[model samples]
Target chain A: MKIAIASGKGGTGKTTLSTNLASFLAEEHEVVLTDLDVEEPNSGLFIEADLVREKDKFKMVPEWSADECILCGNCQKVCNFHAVIQLGEMIMVFPELCHGCYACSELCPTSSLPMIPKKMGVLKHFRNGNLNFVESRLDIGEEQAVPLIKQTHKYIDQQFDDNFIRIFDSPPGTSCPVIEATKDADYIILVTEPTPFGLHDLKLAVETMKELKKEFGVVINRFGIGNDDVLAYCNEEQIKVLAKIPNSRRIAELYSQGRLIYKEIPEVRAELEKMKDLIMGKMKEVVK
Target chain B: MKIAFTTKGTNWSSAMDPRFGRTEYFLIYDDEKDELSHYDNRDSANDAHGAGPKTAQKLFEFSPNILITGNGPGGNAATVLEKTGVKIFIGAGEMTVKEAYEAFKGDTLKKL
Candidate 1:
């Protein structure tokens, strides 16, 4: 089953939960861990993986051919993005503003515009013991992360095996990139804290999950530090609380040192193991 | 020569809008005809993306020889306007569209 670990707020332990859970599950299952946070993929930092493959992710953008000799302004008129502009005899194409929809080229009477490939990011595949790791890194100055996230999922789908357990470490927040990462997953695990900020964003994430109609559970990280409001809210909403990792200095220290707490803390490992079982049971329930 | 000013209202008495792309209206004054007209910029103002270039395209229809506004146009819009031979004049902050045009005619506004 495919599972995604997401959070509405940043630094709320999405990477921490995802990397540890993936490592814990890899002990008993064939696993593929995909870090879909192309803007800042940090899950790979905690896991030891050898780079096995790399692929360039490209998006098609329009390129104007001024030589075709038409300044009809049709391309500019058709572009909703305003990436195409006509200035007397010169036609300018701003690829950065292009959404790659090809509306300009489609509507151009003279066919003066052609869609061209623009490199957006790179997808890297790695192997560490029993786990296959995949992550994407967007190009510097690239504004769009959704396309890269989509490309990463497409790669996962093509190489996915039914026997392997898939884990996606999604970007934080309930925005487009986060939705792109977690949309197709069999289950979603929202990692959050018990603080007010955490609870507020968690409510938004829960709303987003409901809107997407995805079955999701909550994992309260740093459980001992804050009030039980998150638990009460989850209960009120009929959302399952899958696991709680206590607020511990050791876990925080290990995380700060870029180490997986599951390897060092048996309690954390056990909690994650229980989470994996719950996820399997939940998937089975859905299958029924 | 036709002049366009990003404004908050349809008349020359309206304050020049600080934002070019998201301005509420563009007041176009024709020098030859000595007439003033306005185009609603609400569509460009509410555009989720490319408001600057889109607004520039909308203003291009008036064939303005100069554009006067509180601030300069954005990069994409500037590129289009520059290529179309429309001279841009900025620094009309807190001034009415008529005053800004008067400033432009007096060569007091900063050319951008």
Candidate 2:
């Protein structure tokens, strides 16, 4: 089964839950956990594994060639991003603004604009026994993350078959990156805190998930501390509550120390078990 | 020489918008012809991204010799504007279109 653990607000235990759950699941079945948060990937911190392989990821951007020289200004007209523009006798291509759509390059009458691969980030693969962990991190100063995330998904798709139980740790927010990470997952586990901030962002994530028409459930982290508004909201929406990880000082302490809490904390382990069981119950053998 | 001022409105008395990418209007003052013209930039609001570059592309049609705004164009927009030889003058914060034009004539606005 393909599952994506996501949260709308940052610092709501996406990495913590992913690392613990993937590690716990790896004990019995082969599991692949890929971190889709290209900007900042923290799952590697808690995962103790050997380096298996690594690959550089790139995205295509248009390059202008003055040699081909037909100043028809077609590239500028076709480019919806405003990445390419014709100014007087010169044509300029902004690599940062280019969405790699290839509209400008493909439609250029002179073939002056050619698509070129630009290194955007690197993906590292690590393994420990039955678990395979892959994390893609974008180069600093990179404005876009969706392309890198897309490439990461491609890497995961190529490396693992539908038989492998794949889990994705998605980025925060209901924006492009989040959507790209969870689009193909068979089930999404929305991790959320019980505070007002968490409730608001969770509503956004819920709307986005509903828009995508994907199967999903909720897991409320630090449940004992914040108000019951998040739970109340989830109840009203008729979404399943997969598990509620109670507020615990030990869980926070272990997590802060870069340790996976499932092995040490009984409460966290029970929550993980509940989540795992719920996922397993609804999952099909080839669900992806 | 033609100068472009990002303004809140078309009139000379209108305030110069501090924002370049999402400016309401671009008021052009033709030094040679002593004429005034304006382009509505309200359409930029619909752009999800690249507003700066889109604004620069729109301003390019006016072929302004200089662009005077509160904040200068960004990296992408700057590249397009620079190649077209549009000198940028910034730090015209909260100045009216007419006042900013006079400031440019007096060489007071900071050239970026």
Candidate 3:
């Protein structure tokens, strides 16, 4: 079953939950963990997966030929991103703003604009025993994450097996990258805190999941630090409360040191196992 | 020479808008014809992206020789305006469109 762990607010322990859950599941079942947070992928830091392979990610950008080019300005006119611009006798192309749509090349009357590949990021494959970890790391100053995330998902789809329990650690917020990560998920575990900010963002994420018609449950991290507002909201919305991980200094310290809490904390491990059982039960119901 | 000013209102008395892409209106003043006109720029105000170049394209349609505004045009918009050979002037923040145009004529506004 393909499951995604997501949160609307950042630093709400999504990596913590996803990494621990994957490690726990790997004990008895084959697991594939993908860090879809291309901007800042840190789950690999906690897991001892050996880098098996790597591949560069690329996006198509317009390359203009000045010799065959007529400065008709049609390319600039058709470019919604303003990536292509005509300056009198000169034409400038901003590949950073280009969305790789190839509309500019199609609109060029002289056919002087050719689409070329530009490096956007890299995808890495790692393995440790029964656990396989895949990560997408975007290059510095890169604004496009959705494309890289989609590529990473495509990689997962190609390599995914029926026996593998796929867990995707999605980026924070209900943005395009998050959608790309969670679109194919059979079940999404929405992680959140009990604070007001967490509640507000969780509501946004819930709305997004509802719109996408995806089955999702809530996991409240750092549960006792704040009030029961998140649980109250979940109850009113009829959303399932999968687990509530207590806020502990030991876990925080372990996390800060890039250690998996499930390995050291029996309580966290038990909660993750329970959450896994709940997800498996839900999957069985769907299969039935 | 035709001059364009990013403005909050239709008239020359309106304050110059600092944002080119999200400006409420663009006032075009034709010095040769002694005519003044306004184009509503509200369409691009809530644009999710590429508002700068889109607004620059709209302003280019008026064939303005000079653009006076509160802030410098962004990279994309600057590229479009530069292609059209339109000179940009900044430092219209505290001045109304008419006052800014006067300052431009008086060679007081900072050229961008």
Using TM-score, give the best candidate's number: 2
Error at A95, model 3, angstroms: 2.9
Docking class of 1: medium
- Cα distance off (Å), candidate 3, residue B29: 2.5
DockQ of each: 0.54, 0.68, 0.34
Q: Which sections of candidate 1 miss by over 4 Å?
A: A66-78, A86-91, A107-110, A224-226, A248-253, A265-267, A282-288, B93-95, B102-109
Which of the two candidates, 1 or 2, achieves a greater DockQ against the reference? 2
TM-score of chain B of 3: 0.95
TM-score (C-alpha) between model 3 and the true structure: 0.88
Q: What would the per-residue lDDT of candidate 1 be over residues B1-112, giving only the tens digit for each residue?
A: 8999999999978988989888989999998999999999887755666888778877887889888998788877887777678888899968998899889989999988
Q: Taking the tens digit of each residue's C-alpha lDDT, what string does model 3 give over B1-112?
A: 9999999999878988988877889999999999999999998856666777778877877889899988778877877787788999998967898899889989998998
Lowest-lDDT window of 10 residues in candidate 1 chain B? B42-51
lDDT of 2 by residue, A52-113 (tens): 99999889998988997689988888888777878778888777777899898888888888
Candidate 2 accuracy as TM-score: 0.95
> Lowest lDDT 10-mer window, candidate 3 chain A?
A279-288
| Candidate 1, residue A155: lDDT | 92
Q: Which candidate is the best by DockQ?
A: 2
What's each prediction's clash count? 0, 0, 0
Please give the distance, in angstroms, between residue B104's alpha carbon in candidate 2 and its true position after superposition. 2.4
> How many angstroms is residue A83 displaced in model 1 relative to the true structure, after the best TM-score fit?
3.2
The candidates, ranked best first by DockQ, are: 2, 1, 3
